[model samples]
Target chain A: MVVLLLTILQGGMAYRQQAIHGLAVTGLSDQITWGLYIGNFTFFVGVAAAAVILIIPAYLFHRREMRRVTLLGECLAVAAVVVALLFVTVDLGQPLRIWHALPFLGKLNFPTSILAWDMVVLTFYLLINILLLWYLLYKKFCHHTLQVKHYFPLIIVAIILGLSIHTVTAFMLSGNPSRPFWHTAILAPRFIASAFAAGAALMIITFQILHRFSRFRLSKGLIREVALIMAFSQFISLFLLGSEFYTALYRHTAQHSSAVLLYWGTTGSEGLTTAIYLALSASLIGVVILMVRSWREHVPLLNLASVLIFFAIWMEKGIGLVVPGFTPTPLGEIAHYSPTTIEIQVTVGIWAVGAMIFTILARITIAIEYGHLKAIK
Target chain B: MANSRSTRRGFLKGTVAIATLTTATLASSSQSDEPTAFADSIASFLQDHYQRMSKDEIGELLARSERRAKREHGVDIKCHNTSAITGVTFGYALNLSKCKGTRRCVEACVTENNCSRNSNMENIRVLSLPEGTRDLNQSDHYYGVEQKVPEAGRWYLPVQCHQCDEPACVQACPVEATWKEADGIVVIDYDWCIGCRNCAVACPYWARHFNWSKPNLPAKEINKNTHYLGNRPRMAGVMEKCTFCIQRTRKGHLPACQEACPTGARVFGNLLDPASEIRYILENKNVFRLKEEQGTQPNFWYYTDV
Candidate 1:
């Protein structure tokens, strides 16, 4: 409840102010037209995707220890959706005119536009996740009026659809033949793996905090299991990232200039480009530290490892997607763009808003699950 | 230069031999003097298609154009209303050997088109092709003499809108803002444009530029002698491109850029008139169009002096 005001009122209003002003309040330009907003969106989608990683282990693999942790996935997803929507809205040149892409439904560009496809799929996924969440929580609160079995198939499909949605969004920027730097075949896999890794990192921290605050005890073995899932996913995530770098380094693709600018800053300040490089390196170090046998067993060390991986993935997957894309333009000219102060303020505000949403959501889910919010029959 | 060619040709064949010597008489032949035909103007030209605007329709346009001149510029402008003659189209040929890259044509275009000093009106792209490199593909667009200008093994090429027979940009515009004239010039209607920037992507040459804000113009610097055909009032948000100086060319005068070339590398003409300098150049010079694989059929061409 104390964290509510910081997450909701202040963060919410900051985003509202940004939306009304258009992108003028942000740091986008002809050179670096995308920024922290896109980075956050990409990062949050991975966090959302972490729900599936949890779902796969609990439902398909039926890991008995992962059952009570299921609701946390939906809560994280809800937060991610809120954040992703915020970023996409603020990124538009005419934020108010986004409806032009969907004026009264199926009126203009139909099949050809990938942007339009993202709009439809993301909305559907958000709604289905909402229903899955509400139905599950209602079953707990309404004296057995509903069953989890009723929405099992729909939840299963939603998870698959969610994975594809993030992958398609990556292709939206990558598919353009003109944007050579973004034209990578490995972009989709990298996005999926990073989304899982980042999502898993978020879960570790959120679950930890939830356990400390709530009456319900998240079992010791279950906590260990979640950390193990995060660790394995982080390995694949880092491996895919390495493969992409290898291709860019080995091949003298004229398009390699984009990665080069990222690895080595251009003209004085490397800005966010240099920052991402350092952060990714730190994340790799965190991964190594967490790999030790005793780290996941102890609460203090696990917390430290989780924080490191979370920050690492946040830098590697989140900022990595956007800052590198726009440094070099389609004309092969180096166009350096940096985020402004207001842009940073607004972005921090959105993340806070996402936290506020997750907080409110987690509170509601916890009350229902523990019978605190039970209704009189 | 225009009068000398016609007069000399007339003298060589004896002026009396051709019954119609109106070619030498600008006062009797030009349409800039006509005004009344527009005062009681009506769309009397049979609502013809763009390709086949009848002479009466062309006359109606000329009349409407005179009215527009009075309305916009407070001065009269005219259209000669000359039809492109078959087997008589003009083509331009430049001896690449002569171009010294002095940038005289670039300046001439700026003065003639009345472009905003900030926008830099000229579309001349100077590229220095390296010496002993036959691959035009590898040549860089920006060039100095050392990088591959007129050095021991290098040459320069300036490329612009090709005014293609099949233009992708005109076809791609959701609104009918861009159109091609019969004489091969792609033009834009600045007022009707919505600034969607669809045409910018569709263009193979990136010739089109979007006016993201209200144009920075000095009202006094606005060219008062405007034409409905080209260089008129441009709106805040729309696409704009070179119109091959339709105002000058319609009156049968050379483009300002062609007249500005100190090296005489640039050439201008009707592709229809084989008897003109353009046709002579096309037949003699080894001319090439940029990105010919795209099949744009552009009006502009480049070639080596040799």
Candidate 2:
């Protein structure tokens, strides 16, 4: 609770200047316009979408004890969605004009603007998640009287809708012809796989933390299940990345150099390239090491593997995702930009907000599940 | 599952039917923006996608549009005024064949467009392309920092907006903020635009320029005789591009570039009319649109070895 409060304070304090003045507080120029907000928005959406990979195994695939930890994912999802929204608002040149996006108030540019669709889909998905979490918690509150089986179909539908929100976002980036690098058909699938990779890692690490605290109890099986998923997801993300590289290189088309530059730095700059290379190497090594059951049995090594996957995917998605789309620009001037101190602070601020959301929701869900602070029956 | 497929088929059929109806309606009276104004006179009128309004429904709306144009452009010059097909658009043909490395059209576009009149803000660039090459591969757009003119065998292609028939930039704008007029002119509504720059990205011609800073026009340098369709105050953050001087062309005046073209390499005219100088160029010279396979179908055609 205190950690959540501290995070909220940090996020609020950092964002206060921008809210008071305007986007002038940010270092985004006409070139290198999209900064960490877009980066984080892309990253968090992937994390949010990855929740379902675990959700499906537990609820649909009927993994025992998946029930106890699935609520943790729902909590993570709430944070993810909140952070996603907060990041977009921060990203807007005129955050106040955001009210204009609402159809009742302002014109909704449909189909042409993926942002309008993002607004619509995210609003629906958030509502579905909130309702689902409440229904499950409320049932637990009332002495677990309500039949959980009746809600499974509805839960499945909600999961599909939630999945669509992030996939549509990937499509929004990929569909535009202007962004040649973003114009990949494989973006949605790649994003989903990456999301699963990150989410599994995040869940395992968080569960380990909770288990260490001795406040809450979760099955060791669930931890291993998620770690295993993290292993596969890391492999898949790297594979798709390789496929993208192969197509870019062998075709020897005009688009090849930018992708190579994106992965391994153009000329003298080692930017997202370093992250992509380091992350790929570290995660690959971790995945290979973790694939063995005996090594996976070691909690320290498991956590080590999960942390590496988590950070690697973050670096890959955050900087690696945004910069490639911009390089070999429409004019083909590799417009270089380094995030300033303010930009880094603002990114940290967004993380703080996400952390705050996760913390509060975790408290509430934990209380509900273990009957700590039971809801009024 | 069978029912779902049938439903999908039904949806597709309905979509196609709607599309056909739309195209038919558009073709019937697509001559002018007046279709909405005289909708009662025309039959089979389905409402537009912007909002469903008939000719009778939008009299006040159009007045607001005109008012917005006046406020934005700082002139009451007839807004959304369609051009008549009967124009003898006097075009200038640049004989790239006879051209020296003279930067005259560069000066012409500057003066005629009433641009950043201080000579620093000229939109038209005389990109010096190298000998034996038609593409920009040999061109030096990055030729700054005291580079010598005619960099060893470089031929100059005075590159500007090609005034495409199907402009990709026009379609990318989410707010219908930028559009092409009847006179083969692509224009932008800087006020209506959110400056998301989807248009800037969508433009294959790479003709568009963004107003990074509010244009620094000195009081004396400011062209006060601004036309709504031609010269207007551009906003910072919004995208702008060459309009081929619509304000001047619509008034039956030659573009500044055409007037200044000592080589007469640049041509501007109504492509529909066979009598225009551009039409003659089309008939007599082998003119080609840049990046033909992309199918942007630009109105501006390039003539070489003039």
Candidate 3:
């Protein structure tokens, strides 16, 4: 609670500074404009998309045990979307002018602008997840059994919307022909693969926490089942990463040099390159551990692998992806970027806000599950 | 479920209250300024988008902007939001063989455009590349202090906004804040721009720049002739780029960089004019555009009279 409050206070102060001093207060410059905020936005969009994993098992596979925790995944989606939107809001130089992108009141370049598509799709997906989760939780709280027919349609819509959110975001980045690092046919698949790996890993961690703190109990075999899904998804993620490396390095054009620099730093600095290597190594180790049935069955080892997977994806998709795209800028200038103090504060604060939302929603859901709260209807 | 309902209601109320507070604070803060300044601020805040505004509204906004400039910076500025001349799409051709890497055009651009002196923001970048090499990756804008032009087979390439017919920056803008003018110049609506800098990333030429801080130009150095879509003093946190000196070019004058070139290397003329210099160069010379494979269809061209 104290940490959350402190984060909010710090975030408010940083926001005030940004509003008064302009974007110059941040580490962003003309050469390296988008930074940590955009990176976080990209990461959270994947998290939201990964919610489909829970829905698939619960709705499609008809795994009765998975039904209880499916709402948890939807709640996670809501929080992730909130954070993603907040990152965009903070990144804007004129946050107040956001109404300029409004549908009717301001100009929204719908077909032309990929960003416009991203805005609409992300908002729609958020609304869908929120409404679906609320409807399900309400029905349960009112002592009414869920009619699968009613929710089955919503679940299908959510699954499609969830996948589209990340795919659209990938399109947003890859649409920029100028940035060779992002302009690839493989980016969308890689995004989904990594998103599933990270999202499932996060669900594992959240489930463990809820089981410990509340009356919530996971089915006997659910953790290992989810871990198996996470491990396979991690394998796919790694395969995609390898393919990207092969294409970039083998083609050996000036355009592909950004990838080379990202994976193996230039002569001057190897900080980012080393960081990416560490993340890749961590992911590889985690995947190997998960493949071993003995380790996967062990709760502590499983939790450890989950944490590593989360960290690996966060670092890989966050700084490892965004910064290198701009490092050797279009003009072939190497402008290094490190997040400033103010930027870090704002980012942490946004994460805190998301966590708070998730916590509140999860607590309420648990209360309803235990018959501690009554539905007004 | 009831708890969720209450929470949703509270969230909506909180959002409205915050919006109201912010708007009220913004209005009250501007009220502390001079009455005319307050009026100008309100007019600017409520100003319609460029395409939607009536001619009279545009004229009034421009006049008010001029007044604001005088009041704030103590400069007698001419704020002209000139409409594009029909049948006069501008084109530029640069004779690369003649460019001497003097960088005089860069200095002229900064002065004429009132660019940020403190940030050293200049529209034009005169890059010194290896002779007989077209690879822009090996170029450097900051050459050593050799103090002479055309040093040891090094050729200069001055790059600026190409003002492409199919500009990527225009398409990348989420709010249509930037667009290609009818006269082949790509311009940005400074007020309407949310400063996402997506256009900056989309521009392959490295032409666009974002104002990280308010531009710092001395009062005496401020250019009096300003165009609303061109070289007006830009606010902080917005995108700006070269507009072929829209104010000058629209009024039958050469751009500052073209005029400032020591050699007659830069050519600017109406593409629609059959006898214009730009058309003559295009017809006769082995002209090419940078990154033609990108399909940007740039109006700006380059050639060498070997």
Candidate 4:
């Protein structure tokens, strides 16, 4: 609690400094306008989208064991969407004047702007998860049986909305023809695949923590099932990544500057080559570990592989994907971007807030399940 | 006991109301010494978006803006928000062969637009590219202290806002803060912008600049002639770009860069008029737009009269 408070206080001070001095304090310049904030926004949006992996098989496929802990996925999604929204808010130059994008009271260029579509989809997805979870918890607390007929339709919609949120975000980036690195048809599918990989890996770690702390009992078989899903999704993600690298390096057009900057150094710097190599090697190692049945049964190796997969996807999707697209900007100039001290503080604060929210929500849900918390009549 | 609690609550409410009233009174009284300052503050807060404002409101806004400029910068400025003239679609043609990499246009644009001196934001980037190649990778804009101008076979290309017929920046704005005018120039409503910088990334040409800090132009050096959609002083945390010098071009004058060019390389005139210099150059010269395959269809073109 003290740590969270101190981080929040530090973030508050940084925010105040940003508000007074403007965005000049951050590493962002005119050349590379969006930085760590937007990168985190993109990553968290994918995390939110990944909630469907648990929802789909558990609810749609009628997996009884998976249904036991599906609420955990929903809770994580809600927390992630909240964090994503906060990142975008902090990224804005005029944070107070954000009402300009509000519907009706202000001008919202809907249908025409992909960003407007993103705003709609992300909000709708957040609301769907929150309401669905609330309804389920309410029924559970009241000792009433959940009527599938009543909630199934909402779940279906939530699933579609979850997919749309990440797809729309990909469209927002890919729609910019100016940036060749982001302008690709395969980007949306790649985003979904990587999202599922990271999302499943995160849920594995989360469930482990939950099991250790609470009365929530998750079976080894269930963890292995999620691990299998993670392994498959990571394979697809790695394949798509390899395809992108192949296309960029094979053709070697004038548009290859961004890709070169990502794989190799620009002039003197080794660029993000080390980061890319780490992500690739970790993912390969994770896939190899998960592929072996004997190793997957071992809890320690499973946890280690999950951690590796999580970090691999995070590095690949966060800095590896965003920074290169802007480094050798469309006009071909190298403007290096490294997150400043203020950005790092605020990012950590946001993560701490997210963790707090998830912990509280999970605790309440667990208490209700165990009948320690009663529903008032 | 209930009666006592109700009485205490009433006393607390009364105290809060009195405190609020006293604060309001003090705030109004402080501003009462200068009526114009108070009025300006109120007007600024209540100012409508440019499209929603009536003619009379615009007139009042311009007058108030002039007053604010004089009060803030001690400069008598003219801020015009001119409507586009019918039958005059503005176009530009640059003679690339004549450009000497002097960067005179860049300096002229900074001075004319009153761009931030401290941040060094300029709308124009005069690139010195190698001969017989259009590769942007080999181009350099920061050619410092050259012993001579137009150094040995390095041709110059001055890139500004292309003012596309279908601008990507306009489509990227979530709020309709930036848009294309009828005369083919893209303009931004600085006050309405949320400063997401989505438009900056959308633009193929790096034309848009964000005010990272409060623009630090000296009061004496600040350009007095401004346009609301063109070269007006913008607030920190807003997007600004080249607007084809809307203030001057609407009044049948060339853009500042065109006028400032010593080589007579830039030609600006109405695209609709066949007799205009821009149209003549378009019909006669082999002209091309930058990033032509992207299909932004920029009104600005490049040609060589060699």
Candidate 5:
């Protein structure tokens, strides 16, 4: 409770600063306009979209074990979407004028601008997950059985919308033909691959904690199943990373400057050299461990691998991806960016808010599912 | 049930107290730009998009803008909503051989545009390139003024908003706050912009700039003559760029940069007029544009007198 209050206080203070001073308070310039906030926004969008992994197995494959924990996936997505939206809002230069994007009221350039499509898809994804969670939880609370016909369609839509959200976000980044680093055909596939790796890792960790602390009983087999998904996704993510490197490094063209700056340093600017190497190492080690049967079956080792994979993806897909795209600006200026204290405060505050929301939702979910809290007879 | 009710009441009370304290703190700490009249603030807040506004509404908005200049900067300003003149597509051309690496045009543009002084926002950039190379990678953007003008074996390239017919910035704007005018100059409705900076990302030439903070326009420095889409003071958190000196060009005057060139290297005229200098340059001299492969179809051109 105290942490939640502190989060609110700090977040509000930082937001007020952003509101008064505009985006100048952040460490952004004309050279590198989008920074930490956008990075986080992109990462959380992936996380939100990854809920489809559980949805596919639980709903389509009709796996009873996966179905038991699908509620957790939807709840996590809700929190992730909320966090993503907050990042976008805080990053905007004119937060108060956000209504300008509304249809009819303000002119939203749809069909042409990928950003418009991203906004539409993200909103739909959030709403669909919320609706699914509400219906499922309410039914459980009232001791009612769900008819497959009633929700099968909604589940299928959520699954498709989840992919759409991430794909649209990837398109938003790649659509900028001027920025050669992000303007690639492989970006969307790479995003989904990395998202599943990170998302499954996070689920593994969350499931472990819940099983230990509450009446939630997740079998070891279930944990192993999630780890399997993480391993395959991580492998595909590595392959795509290699493909991007080969494409950029082979020709060594002027258009490859962003990748060159990212992997190595240029002149006085070290770029993200050290950070990317560390992420690559973590990714390799985690993938190796997950790929091994004995290591994956071990509970504590599996948990450690999950943590490492999550950190790797966070670093790789977050600042590591975003900052490099802007380093060698389109005009060949090498601009640098480092988030301000206020920016970090606001980011952490939003994460804390997300955690709070997830905890409350998870507690109620557990109570209803376990018959601890329900409608009276 | 009684125990639960009391706990709920206590929780509600705690929330209220926290909420009140937060509001109070925020109110006290924020540097509020509270308008003098409540009704004016409401009207400004609820102002419709520029395209949706009627002529009377635009008039009221211009008056309100003038009033805002008076209140904020203590300047008497005239905000004109000038429409484009028909049968004239404004175009610009620069002679590379005659151009020296003097930034006279840069300073002239800043002074004319009413750009925020604190942000160091300039509409023009003059890059010093070696005599042989056309590669922008080898160009120096921050050419020092301490050196003598036209240093040996160096050529100067002055870049600004090209005002493309198929501008990527216009397409990248999610809120349609920016578009190319009938006269071929791209303009932004600063009030309607949400400042996502997506347009800046989409612009290949780095023409667009954002207001990082409230513009610190001094009354003495403020230009009394301003167009609604050009040279008008902008609020914090909006995008602004070169409008090709729309206020002056629309009034039958040359752009400030064209007037400022010492060697008469800059030329401006209507592209549709065959007798115009810009058209003559296009027909005669070896002309080119930066990033022509991007298909932006920029109206601005660069040529050599050789």
Candidate 6:
């Protein structure tokens, strides 16, 4: 709690400096404009979208065990979305002037701007999850089981929304034809695949912690089922990564230099090469462990695999992906970007806030589920 | 959940306080002669987008900008909202043979556009590439710092905003803060810009620049003439770029770069005019644009004087 407070305080202070002095507080430059904040935003959007990995089987396939734990995934989604939004807020050079993009009051280039679309989809996804959580918690508070008819349509909408929020984000990145590294048709699928891998890994860790520390009697069978999904998604994520690497590095075209620059040192500058290798190594190890049925079912092994998978995806999406896209900038200038102390503090603070939100929401959820917190008539 | 809610609210309140404090600092620092006009600052803060505003609103905004400039730079800048002239489609064609990368155009642009000196945020970048090559990856944007112009077997390509008819920067801007004028110059409403820098990513030419710090325009070097969407003094956090010197071009004056070019290699005139030099060059010369495969339809062209 003290660490969290200190992080927030430091972030708040740094944020003030950033706001007052502008993005100069960041390591971002005219050459490589988007940096640490945007990279994290992209990763978290995937994590948020991963909620559907839980929702799909729970509602669509009618898995009884998954249904009970779907709300936990929704809570995670809510927190992830909040964190994603905060990252964007902190990245903006003029955060207070965001109202300038409001629909009626300001001019939003809606149909044309992929960014505007991303904003809409992300907000809508957040609201949908919030509404779902509220209805479920409210019904639980009133000692009433949920009526399927009331939430059936909402669930369908959320499932589609979950896919879209990340897809739109991918589009936002890929829409920039100028940034050759991000401009790929395969980006959206890659995002979804990686999101599920990371998202399910996070869920496994959270569930294990909950079962160990709290009165929430979550079944091991439920965790094993989630591990299956995580394993499958992680496999797909690795496959996509391999395919992209092969395609980008085969002929080593000029446009594909970003991939080379990311995976290996280029132009006497080793940018994110170490991080990329670390991510790939972790991902491979995690996938191998999770793919084995005997290994995945083991609680300790499952927890280890989850942590590794989560960290790998975070590094892959954050440094390995976003930074390389801008390394040899449009003008062929190799500009280096390393987040300033202010940027790192702000990022850590936002992550802490997200984790705190998830913890509180999970606690309330557990209390309501276990009948420890009941509404008085 | 309730505890988290209060914390979020507290976070917002803190941000608001910080924003107000920063604005107060800006006002105090800029308006030292006059008492701090919080109401005026607030009014400017709540100002409408350039496209949505009435003529009266624009006039008021211009006046405010002038006042801000006078206070900030200690210069009486004539800020105007100059509309594009009718039936004029501006086109530029440069002759590569006669050109030498002297960087006079770059200096002229910075001085004329009131670019940030602290960050060296100039819109134009003169790329020096080896002879007989279109490979941008091999191009050096920061070459010939101390070397003489037109070095042996080296050629210069001065790139700025191409003023595309279908500008990617305009498309990428979430708030429509930027748009192409009737005269074919792509302009940014500095006040309306959210400083997301998506436009910078979208621009193929690396045309757009973000104000990383408060633009440091020395009082003596401040350009007295300014336009709303062109060379006006920008804030600390906004997007600015080459607008083909919209203030000068729309008023029948050559761009600062064109005027400063010693080799007389730059040709700027109406593309629609059949008799104009640019149109004549377009018809006669082996004209091409950078990254033509991107289909940006840039009005700026380059040709070899064969």
In model 4, residue pairs whose N, Cα or C atoms come closer than 3 Å (at least 3 residues apart or on different chains), thus clashing, are: none
RMSD to true structure for each model, in Å: 14.2, 9.7, 5.2, 6.2, 7.5, 5.4
**Runs of candidate 3 exceeding 4 Å displacement:** B1-39, B144-146
Q: Estimate each model's TM-score.
A: 0.67, 0.78, 0.94, 0.94, 0.93, 0.94
* Ten contiguous residues minimizing lDDT sum, candidate 2 chain B: B40-49
Off by over 4 Å in 1: A1-26, A103-108, A145-148, A251-253, B1-306
From the highest DockQ down, the ranking of the candidates is 6, 3, 4, 5, 2, 1
The prediction achieving the highest TM-score against the true structure is 6
Error of 2 at A189 (Å): 2.0
* TM-score of model 4's chain A: 0.97
- The alpha-carbon lDDT assigned to residue B65 of candidate 1 equals 55
Q: Give me the runs in candidate 5 sitting further than 4 Å from their true place.
A: B1-38
Q: Comparing to the true complex, what docking class would candidate 4 get?
A: acceptable
- For A227-301, candidate 5 gives per-residue lDDT tens digits of 899999999999999999999999888888899888877765554678788899999999999999999888888
Q: lDDT by residue for model 6 over A1-377, one digit each (tens)?
A: 67777887888888988988888989889887888999999999999999998889998898989988888999999999999999998988888789878776667799899999989899999999999998998899899977888899999999999999999999988887788898999899999999999999999888878998998777878988899999999999899888888889999888987877777776544546777788899999999999889999988998889999999999999877888898687877777777899999899989988988898899998898788888997
Q: Which residue pairs in candidate 3 collide?
A: none
- Model 2 Cα lDDT, one tens digit per residue, A1-377: 57656755666776776655444456554445565778788888888877787678877888867766777788888889888887877665434435435553234566666666777878877787888888888888777776668788867876897688878878767865656677788888888888888888888888777776646786777777777787787778778977887787777555455676676576544766776788787778777767888898788888788888888778777777776676665444556666665557677777877787777777778877788777564
Question: Which stretch of 10 consecutive residues in model 2 chain A shows the poorest summed lDDT?
Answer: A97-106
Query: Quick one: how many clashes does candidate 6 have?
Result: 0
Candidate 6 chain A least-lDDT 10 residues: A266-275
Quality class of the docking in candidate 2, CAPRI style:
incorrect
Q: lDDT by residue for model 1 over A1-377, one digit each (tens)?
A: 56655644665566566555544455554335557877787777667767887777777787877767778788878888878888777654334334334422112233444555666667777887888888888878887855447777976887787887788777766654444456688778877876766676677777778888985568888778877776776778788778878877787565576776677667844666677777787777767756776866777777777777788777766676666765454333355666766677677778777888888889998888888998788
Question: Candidates' DockQ values?
Answer: 0.04, 0.10, 0.43, 0.40, 0.36, 0.46
State residue A12's C-alpha deviation in candidate 4, in Å: 1.9
Model 5 reproduces a share of the real contacts of 0.71
